[model samples]
Target: MPEPEDSATLYAELLDSARRLSFDLRDCQTGTDDADRYGMTPEWSPLYGTPTWIRMSEPERRRLTRREVTHFLGVAIWLEIALQIVLLRRNHSADPTRPDVKFLFNECADENLHSLMFVGAIEQLGERHSPLDRVMILMGWVFRTFAWEEVAYGIVLAGEEVFDVMQRDWSIDDRVAPAVRRSSHVHVVEESRHMSFARQKMRDRLRGVSRVRRYVSAVLIAFGAHIIAKGLINKGVYRGLGLDWQVARTEIGRNEHHRMMFRRATAPLVEFLDREGLLNGLARSIYRKSNLL
Candidate 1:
């Protein structure tokens, strides 16, 4: 744990960094001739190395990967929009003069730009926005409306960290579409600052909190993580690929390779949550069910 003064200093420094970056959505290059390439790394695909995956033709595999990337980008756009709402609500009640509050506004702006970037990528891929199911829509509404402090920041960090891990790969992988790579690179660069701010906020909010409150917050955060992890890939993706949706879902459920990838992506977040005492028994169980443990 960092001292309060040190945390404050680090937060200020992060604010300075955010100001210096000032990334604009317009700078992202989405006009690339990458229609025939994969939109995500093949190994990262949910069905990678499975019998179903092995049976896929090269064109089919490329189509699946492209739809999967569209699903990911759509989910990111939804999460960003929800997070912008949460940040705006927090800023509305916070002291505007505080550096942290200023960072919140900066974060909201970044999220807005990120959403645009995602939308642009999806458009470039010739895909429309993928909407979440009603259940996830309701869960997102509850979370963005009522979640606060550690819980809010925890959820924010979980979403950003998981995406950051995957995007780090997408941004540099030569096999992925150029537009997807470019948008992912932009997201990764700007989200680093947001993740730092989220960590600082979570630590600050958790300090001196009671055990019972921490326990409850742990469950809530874990539940939020579960929702986020599950929401990334939509069922419509299989339908879009002209496959049986039920079979695809079952295969995805049994995919140890995808599970391993998910666990690896979430390792840093799990470690940080454990260190912060937010990985209680119930939280651990939820994370396990979500394949995020």
Candidate 2:
């Protein structure tokens, strides 16, 4: 709760927290899925009954739909991670006098690795038009708004928190084939710990900041993440198929049938922090700032 006059503790905390956060993701020791696999588990996903009327074959549409949804969202995830490194790099590149170069270097390396995986996923989805690419390009810029110091870190933390649960839920309860399980397993493995680290990092960051700023930023990050998720769902996908925008946005932004599906999307961090005995601060209050409460 001291004012964060020096970024040194933050540097150590960020690294330590990132490492700890990465642990569950790296190891995935205790994972699970929703109990129901009748394809209606979440009951709270914002993306329930998405526009499924494309002309492609069902299997092809399934793969493509999942791929498009995953690839773009993953870009937000990877690029957000990338920008964190970029922020450090921008700071360090010009000021050789900056002492935190070592930490920045570590951040850059991790972001690069994460970015590569995300890029590979994007490439795996074949290709898209210039406009879709433009949407993604613009999204990267929007994600930058969150990365402006603690806000960016918070958003990533929230996102990693979301990623851990959704992937875990999908992986656990479903009796999918082994090959597909890796898809769920790989993500759950890395993101779960990433969420943990983000939680601690936020906890540590709040040690010295104001409650107002803390509360504001936490809601901002959560709302921003929600907005980004909403945008990623897109009106065109649904409206183009003759679905109402209200119905579409509600489904992607606030529906019941897929709630549990995306519940993990918001659950891990809450559970993690609750278990850590680290929740009574500004960040804790921030957790309750949104409808997620």
Candidate 3:
């Protein structure tokens, strides 16, 4: 935990960073050679090293990558929209003059821009994917409606951290499409500020909170993480690629490599949650079941 003075200084720095940054969607336009490139890092693909993956032809693999990336973008779009609503709710009673409230508004604007970028990326890929299932949609409404304080910020941090780790790889990998790389690079740069703001808010909110409330927040956050990890790739992706969806699901379930990647991506979040006393047994179980531990 930061001292009061240190925390205030950090908040000022984060707000300044947010105010200084801007991203233009036009800058992420696809290039001529981008069509021939992968949409994300090949290693991050859920089935990357599986026997089925090894048997896939180049075109099949490329199509799978496109679908997977689009799926990720779609999920990101959903999360960003939810986050915007959550921020707006937070801002409803907040003083606009405060630096924290100002940062929240800035983050909402950033999230709106990010959603547009994700939509454009999907359009560029030209892949048709189904929206998230009804259950997840309902869950999202519940979260954005009722989640507050540490719970809300913890969910935001989880999504941003997971995507940040993956996008960092996609942004620098030469094999990824230029548009994907550019959009990812932009997201990584902007979301770093959002993540920091969320961490600071979570710490502030959790300070001197009750044990029961903390435990409840921890479980809710874990469930939120589960929803995010589970929703990233749609089941329709495998079927779209002309593979057996059932088999692909089974393989993904047992794919230690993909599980390891998930664990690696979420390592920082897990560590932070633990330090904040939000990593109780129930939370750990949920994270483990979701392949996020």
lDDT of each: 0.84, 0.48, 0.85
Arrange candidates by TM-score, highest first: which order? 1, 3, 2
Candidate 3, backbone clash total: 0
lDDT of 3: 0.85
lDDT of 2 by residue, 1-293 (tens): 22243554555655565566542122222222221222212222244355433334444334334434444445445545645653664464445433244455555565555555444433433333112345645655676643555566666665666555555655664443222244455556654444444554456556667757755665566555554444445454444434476855654544444444444466755565445343456554544443333
**Residue-by-residue lDDT tens digits, candidate 1, 145-260:** 89887888888788888889999999899988888888888889888888888887888888899999999999999999999888876887777677887888888899999999
> CA lDDT of 118 in candidate 2?
42
lDDT of 3 by residue, 67-143 (tens): 89998888888888888888787678867767777777788888888888887787787777666867788989999
After superposition, candidate 2 runs with Cα above 4 Å error: 1-57, 60-64, 70-74, 89-104, 127-148, 169-187, 236-247, 250-254, 271-293
Off by over 4 Å in 3: 1-6, 27-33
Candidate 1 whole-model C-alpha lDDT, 0 to 1? 0.84
Report the Cα lDDT for residue 8, model 2: 47
